[model samples]
Target: MTDNIWTYLMVGITFAIYLGIAIWSRAGSTKDFYVAGGGVSPLANGMATAADWMSAASFLSMAGLISFSGFIGSQYLMGWTGGYVLLALLLAPYLRKFGKFTVPDFIGERYYSQTARVIAVFCALFISFTYVVGQMKGVGVAFARFLEVKFEVGVGIGIVIVLFYTVLGGMKGITYTQVAQYCVLIFAYLVPAIFLSLFATGNPIPQLGLGGQVTDGAWLLDKLDTIHTDLGFKAYTSADVNTVDMFFVTAALMLGTAGLPHVIVRFFTVPRVKDARLSAGYALVFIAILYTTAPAISVFAKTNLISALQDKEYADVPQWFTNWEHTGLLGFEDKNNDGKIQYYNDKNPDMDAVAASNGWKGNELTIDQDIIVLANPEISQLPAWVIALVVAGGLAAALSTAAGLLLVISTSISHDLLKKWLKPNISEKKELLAARLAITVAVIVGGIAGINPPGFVAEVVAFAFGLAAASFFPAIVLGIFSTRVNKEGALAGMLVGIVFTATYILCFSVFKMGGPEDYWFGISPKGIGTLGMIFNLVVTLVVTYLTPAPPVKVQEMVESIRYPKGAGAAQEH
Candidate 1:
């Protein structure tokens, strides 16, 4: 069969399975739609949570980012996975014990104010929207190749598929679909890695192969560093960023993982508080399987890319070049009169002599970092079936995370806004209807944002986590830990945290007025969320001391959430 036909058949089979699950598990009431009636098994919930947490960025963009940035990218490896330990120990059990249907529901009652809930809803929406844009990037890249359409058009197609399953099935359907997705994505990721590892180092295990000697008897890292430096790029094993910038950025991402509404909500789905803790352990293990292999893949892919393409004539470029170029991710121009392709860092001043000697104008290749994983199989010359499977896996990552984000958006609106305020008397049937409509609106909005993403998939997701860490992490953690923080204090802290973080982002990213030099204490926009989180805690504690204490009942509720004894099932508060 033709490549396109094979892609269509493979993708069609996965979609069919997802659709069947959605139809069979169609939510019957608001409870099912919101939290799957709160009876999900721990193991099943762990698989689903792993799928939900590993978004398109995790599946596609992350390894690519690492391949380019080298050892510094270990920050992502540490930040994203380490945060789950915090989530399980500091956040998950208490949140589950609270028995609320949504994150904002807990904020609203624990803080004793509708205004606090409204703030939380806004935080959830903003973070989810930022994250959805990344998912769309994955959709665009994966679909564009198989369908032979513009990346933006592919995003539109992905939107329709996600909407069908999400609006039809809600949390229950998504949970099962995600379990399947985790399986697909993990398999797709590993197959090529094992193949490449064996090809390069005569080792089938990627993690060990990356550090082993290649066929030429030179260490892989040593060879890569020598080649990379020759091209004017930093060594793949070197750390080149400022220490302050690296620490805060990594810290923000780690804390933010615990605060994100979608991941946090996953803990609410398991059967009990103990199940929540166990599921987190399981989820982290599943996630680590991909995390550890990615850096090795990054090194392997980068080595192959340079060896294959560098200094080669433009006329002799591989077919993979044409395929990726058609997607607009790989760009080339014959800048110099020379017919040969020169893919080196032209930005380095030391390269001026090299360019003049070779009669090269500048770097003739432009490749987006996000394209690395999607292009890996082809770069390594894998079979057509493997390439098709990788595409399906990319879609699975994007659609699964999109489904989880849509749930957060719907719950924030239907439960926190409409039922809590506009129509306190709404029935379960009506609430379910509102949730579906809210989901439809969210998908449309998310799709629109994806068309003109603010940054690459992984960068956008990092910012989303930063926002979540700054805005929600402090309040949720404080509320569970201390009864002294009143509604007024919590509200003030969230407002300040969000505004401070957003202002910094706008200053550097939007207005372009404040450069990194203008950033506080050498902290970049990526790490500003750490400052915001600290600001929140300080403001909350100060305000609590100055104001009257919370009511005794509220204090009792705080203590109840903290203790593990007699923890009940998750319920619609």
Candidate 2:
């Protein structure tokens, strides 16, 4: 390890600043805790939302997935960022105008039934729980490496710090802290990317460097394409993935981003509907900065990785080789005793001869794709501080997302489920206390789940988006636009839609329910969630038409939510 005292000091100072802000901004009322008293400026809220939305998976894991998946990975980049567009066009402004404290509140009232609200609350809790697990796990990994602590210890430290401010400041504390986090994460993500770009391609801009020409006068993408094809791998910039699945995956992600309970709650912090719209635009711009750079980073890293290992002997490899090998990340087996690790697509029949002749044992480099982005700084020989910053950025992404998810979970339990349903007469202080307790429990469960993450973090995350799209997005949109949808229709929609969506995902993903050979037209888990969304929309519409219209009073409530001025007071009461 590099004996860089200053890097540790800087990291320490950053953490201290975050703690101080959280304490200073602690919320004083239910309003403060839930929506920061609806006083946030559009720009500030936009920045905070960006921080909340761009989690550890985005910062630390996405580029790595891209690096390994090649052209197939662009779907993630496009799906995630493009989802913002759908949010802007379809959901954000109208939901902000509704002026509710929580998603379940809208669901309950819009459907004119407590049952709908309770189901909405359960949906929010489940989605938040699943998503937060990944974020907390990310925190453990980053802290373990950077702070030199055991993974569980690091998770405990993180849980304590998050609980302190989250309980104290509520939405108020989390919002401002998220602003700081946004800066830290963006700086952390971009600096290493810039350095790597400059080092490998002599280019300053990562986006251009990805496709730029190298010293050998070949375009980077062209070279990657050549290598991948030569090794029986698909082209780096082109893939053979199904177009329909791609379309739905992209659509589901976009709709899901718009529909996520925690993200939507942030828009409520803005003062008006106009601010909500403007804030979505700003959030997209903030997110786009990283999204645009990420693919470039992926391309560069993959190209660099292959070139570094092409003909190098095992013993001659750098210290990183041994270090990663110890972690079970890098493996080498010389099949023919050539003493050189040959990296090729083992699945490619054309490369089998090369593997046999060159003594390459089925391309033995087993480094998990998730490690690729974090490994970039080291690969490019960036300074120790840059590497340290990467650690901080990973933490920021994980923690910020975890904070947002916990808030959603707490609010749904305390405000929507308990205060609204179980104990309508509960005092504000008790509600606040309950919220805190819920948050603590949420953190503990999330941390435990993090220890044994299900599937790759990014792929599993796609399920949350799909769930939101199928269940919440349709209800919210129909609630806002069509005043006639009754409680029965919505309830039927959510249940049927969720069931179909879940069944579809489980079918292809876990149960082999579809069969050993068939896959509903080859819809993989990564893209099947999109199909689930479509099923939800259709089920919801069909049920709504068949059911009786909502009572006139419920129609009036929908009308009231369309305008910002009158609905706020009623929601507060």
Cα-based lDDT at residue 35, candidate 1: 84
Q: After superposition, how far is residue 406 of candidate 1 from its true place, in Å?
A: 0.9
127-214 per-residue lDDT for model 1 (tens digits): 8888888888788888887687778888889889989999988898899899989998999898888988999999999999989999
State how far residue 532 of model 2 sits from its true place (Å). Answer: 2.0
Structure candidate 1, residue pairs in collision: none
Name model 1 segments beyond 4 Å from true: none
For model 2 the local lDDT of residue 276 reads: 80
Model 1 / residue 367 / CA error / Å: 1.0
Candidate 2 regions with alpha-carbon error over 4 angstroms: 1-7, 148-157, 323-339, 506-517, 563-570
lDDT of 2 by residue, 372-392 (tens): 666667666678888778877
Q: TM-score of each candidate?
A: 0.98, 0.93
What's the lDDT of the predicted structure labeled candidate 2? 0.79
